[model samples]
Target: MDIDVFAATHAQEWKRLDELVRRRRSLAGEEVDELVDLYQRVSTHLSVVRSAGQDPNLVARLSALVARARSAVTGAHSSSWSEVSGFFTRTFPGTLYRLRWWWIGASAGTLLVAFLAGAWVVLDPEVLNAMQTPEAMRQYVEHDFANYYAENPGTSFSAQVWTNNAWVAAQAIVFGVFLALPTIAVLAMNGAGIGSSAGMMIVHGRGEEFFSLILPHGFLELTAVFVAGGVGLKLGWTIIEPGDRPRLRALGEEARAAMAVALGLVVVLFVSGLVEGLVTGNMVRGRIATPVGLGIGFFVEVLFLAYVYTVGKRAYRKGETGDIRNTPEAVPVAG
Candidate 1:
């Protein structure tokens, strides 16, 4: 209980702990183990000294030593740059590749719905009328549709488009927890909107114009949406049939993966927004040629798909699951 005796007895161990902490980066395996052992012993000494109402100076010294030792033992976290790099190279693409089928199916289904809706709207004058009056529809096809892109400054317009599309994609992924109905509805509504617009334009003999504007941005934007919808549905399906894992555990895994997809889509949608605002809008304003704009959009879309298949497939093959690394497993409970 004597403060002086306690300090003297543990002085060597404390000094060793300090030395180890100072040289943590260069520590040998045995020295690392010794540092950990000293850390534990010194921690106990500090606790005992405090219990005995010991010397304030000794207490302060031990406190500092223990803090440094703790840091040394735990080591520093991965750098922010490392984390960002890992997410893009491993986590994001791996998730995309792993869930490729789900999103691909989503893309196919949504496109099919859009095509059918467009055809129906073209064939059924009543359907077209139900959507809008003839005058309003004509105005939309000739002016409103084309003008929407060039109405705002390119930077501000890109920001707005990015925000809106990102929110929609986030909704599609986050709402997957509700058994995917919301995700399905989002996809359906999006497809229907596109189809209606296309149908209206085509019927007015402006199909080329519609595509000229839409294709420059729509390819990537729609793909990002399809990815979100697919991931969302997968999350919901986990609730329905979790396979070999516990239902809650499966849901947790999928939910985390869904979050990664959401974050990745932010970057994806930003690029799409840039295309819409800069390339598509410029095309309308006669700032860029139609073929050049279309080529730029197509190149971006192809590059993205190629990145997903190559980087994503490689990462997935290496056992990357797109979930956060080293997440603590849930405690096992006996049924």
Candidate 2:
């Protein structure tokens, strides 16, 4: 096909399509129909021009014209406050509810590991000694551990904690592609760290103090971590078992859902960070009573659980999969 001849033949339609798109907002009913018709014809012209491998300039012009015309025909999407509200009320909770089993198991398994690790440390003097010198252990149990929360200013500390925890959560979700080994490692390391700390405190008779400080934030913070780990494992498992969908397609779907969890966790971790830096820190500093702090943290944790079960369950029931709404179906590929 002669590029010049093709351009001359379709030049009029392209010009008309451009005009229609520019005046799309004020188009009359007949003009709208005409715009749609020209949009299709120009799209075909673009395909033909590209396939012919002639006149790159002409191809570029047609591509841009087609894009504008298509947008005019289909309309454009814009973000709104409703989208933000829907994310929290429906998407986040629904995702949490849908993946409830995965995260719950993660929580149970992590807690068990923590328990076993603490028990081991308490039961074995040699193991405990190997972990730290007796003096250092005493220092940590008596002062260092408690001082951690109050050492930094509350606002900065909260920001620091939020960033650190968010990074951990992101790692768990992103690294899940490696068969979840990294996610498991992350969870195990977290559990062992908590358990060892608890063991050290319990051995020194500060177990009550430990719980008072840790539980005030650990309840929610740890849950967020568990959610990330569970979602990561689910992602890894998707690679192993994609169900009825093609492996790549299934992975794509789950990966998108994992991203939603990742984003939701940022907010979750932020709240936990505030509790840790403000409530727990104040309790350590004697500004707030230990019992009140504990109650506040517990309440927050309970609130999150309630949100998941209520909003999340409702959204899931309504067919919310936590994935982006209206995701285009994957095109079939030949093997």
Per-residue lDDT value at 277 in model 2: 95
Question: Which residue pairs collide, candidate 1?
Answer: none
lDDT per residue as tens, model 2, 146-261 = 99999999999999999999999999888889989999999999999899888988988989999999999999999999999999999999889978765665676688789998
RMSD of 1: 10.8
Best by lDDT: 1
Tens digit of lDDT per residue, candidate 1, span 162-210?
9999999999998899999999999998998899889989999999999
Error of 2 at 305 (Å): 0.6
Find the candidate with the highest TM-score and give its number.
2
Poorly placed runs, candidate 1 (over 4 Å): 1-76, 327-335
Clash counts per candidate, in order, are: 0, 1
Model 2 segments more than 4 A misplaced: 1-79, 328-335
TM-score of each: 0.78, 0.80
TM-score of 2: 0.80
